[model samples]
Target chain A: MESTYLFLTTVTIQSSMAVLFATLGEIVTEKSGILNLGVEGMMLMGAMSSFAASLYFKNPWLGVTCGLITGAFFALIHAFFTIGLKANQVICGLSLTIFGMGLSSFLGRFLIGKTGTRFLIWHVPILNKIPLVGPILFNQTPLVYLSYIFVPLIWVLLYKTNIGLSLRAVGENPTAADVTGISVVRYRYLATIFGGMMAGLGGSYLSLFYTPGWKENMTAGQGWIAIAMVIFSTWNPFRAVIGSLMFGGINALQYYFQASGITIIPNYILMMLPYIFTLVVLFLINQTEGAKRKLGAPASLGVAFEREL
Target chain B: MIEIKVKQRIAYPKITKFFTPFFALFFALLFGAGLFKWVGVDPLKAYKIMLSGAFGNFYNFSEVIVRGIPLILSGLSVGLAAKMMLWNIGCEGQIVMGGVGATAIALFASPYLPNYLVIPAMIFSGFIAGALWIFIPAIFKAKWNVSEIISTLMLNYIAIIWMEHLYFGPWRDPEGRGFPGSAIFPDAAWFPRYLGTRIHLGIFIVFIVTILIYILLNFTKLGYEIKVIGESELAARYANIKVTRNIFIVLMISGGIAGLAGVGEVAGVYHRLQQGLSSGYGYAGIIVAWLGRLNPWGILSVGIIFAGFMVGGDALQLNLQLPSSLSLVLEGALLFLVLAGEILPKYKISISWKKLSKS
Candidate 1:
C-alpha cells in the first residue's frame, strides 16, 4: 500500500510537470496581455524538434535547447504577426498552432517510432534519503526539477520584481505602460518568447522524460489543458501548481484504473475528465464574482496593442 | 539603422480587401517554396503536381467537391458565429456528435421509419446533437460571460472522446470481425449521389445553406442585431438588442451547421459512423471561415480552393512521398499571411534606413 501510495504521488508529479511548465509559461505570456492560443502547436514542434535533434546529436541537453529554440521560433512568428503587424491575436495564434502542428508532422514523419536520447531519472543524494516526500520529489528528470524551480521563480518574477511590474502594466494597460517609458512591444515580445520556451520545455519533458519518444499530436491536448490551467489558476504561477497537479492527478487516476483492471468506469470517460474539468473550472471562475475580481484576466488580454499616433 | 513608421489609413479601399487574399496567397506560395526547397522537393514541380492533381480530371474535381462539402458547412458554421465575434472552436466536436446522432438514427430507428422520414430525421437529429453539444458553452457565455473559445475547445475534446466511446464500446458491430465501428448504415440512411462520381447531395445542401445564411445575415432583424453586438456589446445593450439571446441563437445555428458537415460524412459519403470522420475538417473550417472573411460566398469559394489543396496534398503523399500534412502547412501559412495582410487596409507602413553621424 505504501508502494502504491508512493507510485501514485510520483506519477502525479511526473505527469503534471509538462503542463506545469506550460502553465507557468502561459501565465507570463498572458500577463503581458497577449493571449497565445498556439501552445499545442508550439509544444508539438518543440517535441518533434527536440526528439529529432537529440536523436541526431545523441545529447539530451542539445535536444532540450533545440526544443526551446523551435518553440521561440514559432512564438516569434506569432509575435511578428500579432504584435508587429497588428493582426488579430486569436487568428494569428490559431494559425501558429495549425502551422506548427502541420510543420511538425511534416518534419517528424521520419522520427516516428524512433527512440532518441532521453533524460533518465536522477535522484538527489541527500534529498532522496528523506521521508516519503523525498523519493517522490527528488527522483525525477532534470525537466521535472526545472518545473519545480519555475513555479516559485515565475511567482517571484511576476509578483516581486520591477520587470514583472512592467510586464503586468504592459498587459493591463499598454498605453499607460508606454507613457511610463516601458516598451510595450519589447516586453510583449520577450514575454511571448519566454512563454514559448517554457512550452517548448514542457514538450521536451514529454518526449525526453515522460513518454520518451516522438509521436504525432503527442502532447495530446496537454497544451490546451495548460492554457486552461492558466485560467484555472487565475493567471497566478503558484496556483498553477494546483491546476497542473489536478490534471496530473486525473492522468494518474486514469493510469491507475487501467493498470488495476478496473472496469467500472469506461476508458474514454476517464480520458475526458481533464477537458470536462477545464469547462467546470471555467464555469466556476465565471460564476464566482470574488474569484473573478481577484483573478481577472489582464484588461488588454487578446487585444493587440497600438499606441495612438 | 532602419526606422519604420505606420500611419492609419483615412480611407480604406474596397478593392484592397478583394485583392488581399490573392496577395496573401502569392506570399504564402513564395514562403512555401522555401519550405519545399528545405524539404528537398522542387517547388515548381510540387506546385504543378498539386494544381494538376486537384483539377486534373472530372473525377478529381468531383472528389474535391466531396471534400469541400463538409468544409463549406463547417466554414459557414464558424463564419456565422464569427459574425458575432464568437469563436466556435468546438465545431470539430460538434461534427463528431452530428455523426453520432445520424448514426444512432441510422442504426436504431431506420427500420421503424419510412424511407422519406429517415434522411430528414437523421438531418434534424444531427443538427440538434451539434446544437446541444455547443449549447452548454453558449449558455455559459450568455449567462456568466465565460470565454466561449476555451469552453468550446474543451467541449471539442469531450465530444471526440464520446464519439470514440460510442464506436469502440457500446455501438461496436456484433458480427463485424471485432472492427472498432458500428455496422454499415441502412440504404434508407444513405444519401443520394451523382451517377458516376463520389459526389453526393451534400453539394446542393451546402449551396442552399450558404444562400440562406447570406440572406439571413444581410436581410434579417436578428442579423442586424448580431452585427450590432459584434461591433460593441455596450452599444448593442443601449440599442435594446438582446445580446445574450442573440449569442445563444447564433451559436446554436453555428453548431447545427457544423453538425450538418458531420451528417454529410456519415450519411452522404461513408454511410457509416467510423473513425477518421472528424479528421480536422472542423479546424480547417476555421481557416476557411477566416480566409473567406466570414462572408458566405467567400467561404464557399475559399472552401472549394482549400479542398483542392487537400486533394493535391494527397497527391504529394502518393507521388512525392511527402506527408499529407503539407496541405495543413500551406493552409496555416496562408491564414497567417492573410492575417498579416489584414493590417494593410487599416494602416500605411513605411521603412527607412538611416546612417548614424560621427560625434
Candidate 2:
C-alpha cells in the first residue's frame, strides 16, 4: 500500500509536468493576443525530434535542443501564415497541426522502438529525507526539476516585468498598443515562438523522460488538453501548474485503477473521465461570474491583424 | 526605392474562380514532387503511379469513388455549418454516434425487417444519432457562449471511447473467438453493392445530397440567412435572422450529414461496426471541406482528389516500399499550398528590389 501510494504520486507529478510546460507555453502565447491551436502538432514535433536527436548525437542535451528547435519551427508556420500572410488564424493553426502531425509521423517511423538516452532520477541529498514527498518530488528527472523552476520563473516573467506589461497591452488592444509605439506584431511573433519553444521543451520531457522512446503520434492529445488547461487555469501561468496537476492526477489514477483492478467500472469509462471532466468544468466555469471575467479571452484573440495605411 | 504591395483585385473574373482551385492543386503537386525527390523517388514517376493507381483500372477507379462518397457527405456537414460560422469540429463524434445508431438497428432489427425497410431505417437512425451528438455543443454555443471548437473536440474522445466500450464489452461477438466487435451485419442491413464491385449505393446517396445542398445554398432563403450570419453575426441579427435558431439548425444538418458518412461506412463498407470503421474519415473530411471552399460542386471534386491521396498511399506502400503515411504528408502539404494560393485572387502581390539611396 505504501509503495503504491508513492508510485501514484510519482506518476502524477511526471505526467502533469509534461502538461504544465505546454499549458504554460500556450498561456504566454494567448496572453500576447495570438490564439495558436497548433500545440498538439508542435508537441509531436518536439517528442519525435527530441528522441531522434538524443539517439543521433548520443547526448540528452542535444535532444532537448532538437525538441525546442523543431517545436519553434512548426510554430513558425502558424506565425508566418497568420501574421505574415494575414491568413485566417484558425485555418492556419489547423493546417499547422496537420502538417506537423504528418511530417512527424513520416519522419519518426525509423526512430520508433530504437532506444535513446532517457532522463534519470536525481535525488537531492537533504530533500530525499522527506517522508511522503521525497520519492515523488525530490527524485525526478532533471527536466522535472527544471519545470518547477521554470513555472514560477515564467509566472514572474509574465506578471512582474515591463515586457509582460507590454505583452498584455498588445493582447488587450493591439491598435492602441501600436499608437503607443509598441510593435504588436513583433511581440506576437516572439510570444508565439517562445510558447512554441516551451511546448517543445514540454514534449522533450515526454520523450526524454516520461516515456523515454519515440512513437508515431506520441504526444497523443496532450497538446489539445493543454489548450483547454490554459482556459481552465484562467490563462495564468501559476494557475496552469494546478490545472496540469489536476489533469495529471486523473490520468495517473486511471492507470492505477486499471492496473489494480479495484474498480467495477470498465477501463474505457475511466478513459472517458478526463474528457467528461473537461466538459463539466467548462460548463461550471461558464456558469460562474467571477470565473467568466477571469477566464475571458483576449479581445483580438483570433482576429487577423491588418495594418491598413 | 523598391516596394511591395498587395491590392484587392476589383474585377471578379468569373473564369478565374474555377481555375484558381486548379492552380492550388498544381502548387500542391509541385510541392509534393519536391517531397518525393527528397525521399529519393522520381517525382514525375511517383505522380504517374499515383494517378494510374487511383484511376488506371476499373477496380482502382471504383475504389476512389467508394472512398469519396463518405468524404462528400462529411464535407457537406462541415461546409453547411461553416456557412453559419458555426464550427462543428465534433463531426468526428457525430459520425461515430451515427455508426452506433445504425449498428443498433442492424443488430436488433435486421432479423425482422425486410431489406428495403432496414436500409432506410438505418440511414434515418444514423442521421438522428449524429444530430443528437452535435446538439450538445450547439446548445452550449447558442445559450452559454461556449467555444464549440473545444467542446466538440473533447466530445470526440468520449464518443470514440464509448464506441470502444461497446466493441470490447457487451457488444463483443461471442461467436468470433472473443473478438472485440459485433457480429457481421445481416444481409438485409447491408448496402447493395454494384456490378461485382465494392462500390455501394452510398455513391448515389452522396451525389443526390450534393445536388440538394448545392440548390439549398444557392436558391434558398435559409442559405441566405446562413451566409449573412457567417459574414457578420451582428448584421444577421440586425436583419432579424434568428441567429440562435439558425446556429442549431445548421449544426443539426452538419451533424446529420456526418452521421450519414458513418452509416455509409458501417453498412456499405464494413457491414459490421468494428475497429477501423472510420480510418479518420471525419477528420480528413475537414480538409476536403475547406479545400472545396465549402461549396457542393467543389466538395465533389476535392473529395475525389483526397480519395486519390488515399488510393495512391496504398500504391506507394505496395510498390515503392514506403510507409502509407505519405497520404497524410500529401494532404497536409496540399492544404497549406491551396490556402496560400487562395490569397492570390483576393490580393495581388508585387515585389521589387532596388538599391537604396542614402538619406
The superposed Cα distance between candidate 2 and the true structure at residue B235, in angstroms, equals: 1.4
How do the residues A24-90 of candidate 2 rate in per-residue lDDT, one tens digit apiece? 8998898888888889889988999998999989898899999999989888888887777777777
Model 1 CA deviation exceeding 4 Å by range: A289-291, B1-5, B349-359
Cα lDDT of model 1 by residue, A1-309, tens digit:
998798789999988988998888899999999989999999999999999999999999999999999999988888888788878888888888889889989889999999888999888999998998999999888888877778888889988999999999999999999999999999999999999999998998889889999888999888888888888899888889998898898889898889988878888989999899888988887777456656757989989897887
- Runs of candidate 2 with Cα error greater than 4 angstroms are A289-296, B1-18, B344-359
Lowest lDDT 10-residue stretch of candidate 2 chain B: B337-346
Model 2, span B1-359: residue lDDT tens: 77898777777668877787778778878888888898899988888888899989999989999988887888888888877777777778888899999999999987888777999999999999999998888887787767777888888888888998898887878797877688889888999999888899899889888988988888999888888999999999899999888888888888889899899999999888888767667778888889888988988898998898889888887889777777887788778777777666777778888789889
Q: What is the TM-score of chain B in candidate 2?
A: 0.93
RMSD (CA, angstroms), candidate 1: 1.6
Q: TM-score per model for chain B alone?
A: 0.96, 0.93
Instruction: Assess candidate 2 and give its TM-score to the true structure.
Output: 0.96
**Model 2 chain A lowest lDDT segment of ten:** A288-297
Clash pairs (backbone) in predicted model 1: none
